[model samples]
Target: MKASHDLSGLVKFLSRDDWAFHFEEVMGDHFWPVMDHFDLDHEEINDALGDHWAMTLWGCAFEDFLTQVFDPGGQTFVEAYLKRRSWKESAQSKAYMTALGTSVMSLYEASEIVPGKSFLARDLIRGGEPVLISEGTATKTLRQWERVAARIVPLGGKLIIAGGLLPFSQEASDALLEGFKALPGKRRRSRTQPLLDDEMLRAAAPLFTHAFLFDVLPKALGETRPIIHNSDGDEIVFHEVRFPLATGITRKDIAWRLQGIPQLRQENAQFWNWLDERSQKGPLKARVPNALAAGTTMEDGTPVLGNLELKGRFLTLMVNSAARAARGREMLENVLGKMVGVPLTTIQTIEQMQEARKGRTKEVDDIPLEVATPLVHAMLDKQYREILDQPVGMLGDISPRSAVGTQKGREKVAEWLKYLEFRSASSQNPHDPMTTYDFGWMWRELNIENLRR
Candidate 1:
């Protein structure tokens, strides 16, 4: 299939790998080399760069560049192209253009400009300026431009539109659109698939069984500060409450909400000490470095630490946004297949449910385990709530970036799908029952206790 149309699968397929992914080729005729005549240092030349620089060099963002290039413009394709570049570079109020203009022009002809500088050539033909790509014959960094371009464009509101060259045989654009279209529906109407097929009790066959519990996990128990009891006469301590009854009960659901939990900054020395102990065991693998570990020291120069310092209990606030469903699903599959430690489908389902619940209407069927999942699932979905934004943070504050994606938050739909897969696959069974590896104490913590609280 054309690379442009194959974007859906390509994105999903690529996400299974590390953070850095290459999409320059997938861009096809849509992109052109921006540095055809630049005098860049070897290091900058060798690194991956995003096409955004090219766009910026042309005096517009990626999308702006596209509209201008594809739509009718006066000058000869070359003149218009150079005109745009001059404008783009000048807007930056820098000498990047004048300093490298001549070099950029000469490189496009597939001829060397400066001995050790670089060269570039147009590959794909779309509208006016042929899409310049790395001919590889040049000594400069070809890929770096694309890499930088990718980061800047997406982070901004504009989408890095690409069409044509697909790695596989597919209408990459259509597939991408299909996935994009599906994002909202999935977010609005969560897709809940069964975790297992019922099997009769046998001498030895795996069967699924789930347990539910509810409790208030006080910060003090973990060697942190105590929660402040409100003026109400209700209890401050979180007792081991029963199921179903506990399922819907969030901190907000409680009659007299537990109050006065100290902010992480106020966390007493005990918290820091706990972090130290946990750090000594090993790297204390975490999403971010352990700050507490760096703060405190032990009696014999020994350390104390609370293995995983939680920032806050997961938040489940309703949000209004747009998403691409196909992308969400592909993201789920990639995450699951790559992060073997976690399940995929479950999280997706949970995200779908949460998005649906945010709306006034109910769209999808309820899974048998709906009541069993934590209340957070009703809002943020499992994958996003737990994985993307770790249930654990510094001690009551989530990172600013953990919120939105299309804007600046985590992709909620993808996260929920992952969570669903995690919860479902981890359910206990009769013969081959679930173990800590599948449903560990932490899982239990997610389901029952007042974690974020």
Candidate 2:
């Protein structure tokens, strides 16, 4: 029988008069957060989260109830259910139930997932070696770096997660960690400190459901949008501002003028990069004899602000925001003078750009997979090689190379790597070259291959 069947049987037993109050208490604790947060009633929760998540919420609560201690002696709903229904359950079911009674609910980070087979679960709330979970269905759907709050119980010598599995978003996971840190009776020395003792985490398990719902509900209810923004914090809107060459002006004239500008770096005959003069001069340099001192800024650091290209009769500037397009237009006008005519602009949001790409006709001479895969891989290799030494916002603005120098930074880097791998694997097209690219080399290069597990 499936685990859900066994859990349902136990739930039926718990509905009896003798155990109903304990069941209600656990259910209330789990549901109250979502209800209170949205000012929702019991019936409205199902409407809000929909059937799938509502059932998931209930399953999580029921599993949490299995671990609850009812009295000072520590009797639990699982014990009560097994006492009345053990004879009806199979040996495996009985063992599962017995294990659930003692299991604790905690957040876990999944890694090395083999769809329809198994995955490793590293406890985020309680520090320990990762446990291998012999899961089938969840593994098929779970992404790498996905966090879930669940109970990992050993059933017949192999570890299996209990029926209640709550998948958490990154925001929810961070909130849950913060909630644990803020709980009374224990003080955490640092944000990276190991989680509270097992009993404390278990007692505060409802916070897991709360945090998950807090992040999920707003989006589910259409209260938020998945907004993408540029590093400047402006919503991303691609702008292509084109200027026609004035009567006698030619591409050569514009190229010559652009070459003389310090902010524009010519890439080829037709393309130039518009650079930001205000970007930081890379990371700090270490002080040494006859070397640059720490905190001393470099002279040649310029981040790309936009791009310029000469196509046919037009000089085109491409930027990610309207503000950048305006500034780029002014700069080009001041330099080109009567060499360029009045500008024409085109704007597209990310969604519009995606739709435009989908609507475009495919090239007749498409590259073969064998040729394309290597080219794409080569491009990605070059991109990531530079990324290794560049600051990543996710890693607290520290470069991955610098991050690996400390234990805490290494942990963050590992998580960041998992996210990159997961996103690559989740690419929409199965045949996309990115989907097949191996990130194992990245881990090895960073000397954190062992942590890939």
Which regions of candidate 1 are displaced past 4 Å? 1-276, 280-369, 374-453
**TM-scores, all models, native as reference:** 0.16, 0.78
CA displacement after TM-score superposition, residue 341 of candidate 1 (Å): 32
Q: Write model 2 residue lDDT over 99-172, tens digit each, in one string.
A: 88777889998988899999999888777778899999999888776789888888888999876798986657
lDDT computed for candidate 1: 0.24
Off by over 4 Å in 2: 1-5, 72-74, 189-193, 223-229, 236-238, 246-307, 330-339, 348-371, 382-416
Cα lDDT of candidate 2 equals 0.77
lDDT of 1 by residue, 1-453 (tens): 232212232223323322112223212112222222233432342243334333332221221222211224332222333343433323222221221211111001121212234332221101123222322223332221111111111112222212211111112222222333343222222224211111111100100000000011111123344322211211122211111213343433221221222111213321211222223321112222211112122212222211112122221111111122222223323422322222212122334555767867644774444353444344334433344344222211333234332332233322332233333433344222211122233323334211101
The candidate scoring highest on lDDT is 2
Report the alpha-carbon TM-score of model 2 versus the true structure. 0.78
Best by TM-score: 2
